[model samples]
Target: MAGQKGDPVMVDERRFTSFADGETSLELHGLTFENGTDALAVYGNGVFTRDAAGRAALAAVVDVLRRAVAALDEAGPAAQALPDGDGRGDGATSVANPFG
Candidate 1:
C-alpha cells in the first residue's frame, strides 16, 4: 500500500520505508521465502536459493555479514556515530546488502 512520503508501507506483509539527506538516500524493504523451495524472494529481481548456485550465493552473503560484524567490533564506538545522535546506528546500519 502507498503511504505518505515518509511513512512505512506494507505490501504482502513486508514493510517498506526510506530515508534521505542531501547526499544520499536509502530504501528499506523486506524479503520473503518461497513456501516450498525456501527461495528468497526479491521484487524485480526474482527468487534465490532454489538451486545449488543460489544457495552458495546466500551463504556468501552470510559470510560477508559475519566479516562486517567483526570489522565493526574492531572499529568500536568511533565507527557508530550518526547525525541523529542515536546510539542505534551500530545496531541499525551495521549490515549492508553486499549484493547490491
Candidate 2:
C-alpha cells in the first residue's frame, strides 16, 4: 500500500501451504518505500530447514541463490533456471524452490 505526503497505511496478509515435504521453513515479508521515490521496495527472507543435515544442504542452496541474485543485480537482467550441479544418476529426487 502507498500513501500521500503524511497519510497512514495498513496491510493484510497470510500464508497457506499444501504440505510439508522437506525440512523446517519460515518466511517473512515486508514492504517499504524511499522518501522521494515512486516505486515500492519489497523484501523477504525464507529460511529452510532447522535440522542439522537439512541446514547444511539448505545453506549450499542459499549460496547458489546469492550468486544468481548478484548476477541479475549486476547485469540488469534475470538469471534463467539452472541446475546446481550435474545430475549423475541420482535417480529420482525432488527439487525445491526457495523463492516460493
lDDT, candidate 1, at 25? 20
Tens digit of lDDT per residue, candidate 1, span 6-78?
A: 3433334643332212222212222322211111122334245578977855554344334333433444574
lDDT of each: 0.36, 0.33
| Residue 67, model 2: Cα distance from true site in angstroms | 0.7
How does residue 3 of candidate 2 score in lDDT?
Answer: 22
State the local distance difference test value for candidate 2.
0.33
Off by over 4 Å in 2: 1-49, 76-100
Cα RMSD to native, each candidate? 16.4, 18.4
Model 2 earns a TM-score of 0.26
TM-score of each: 0.30, 0.26
Which pairs in model 2 have colliding backbones?
A: none
Best by lDDT: 1
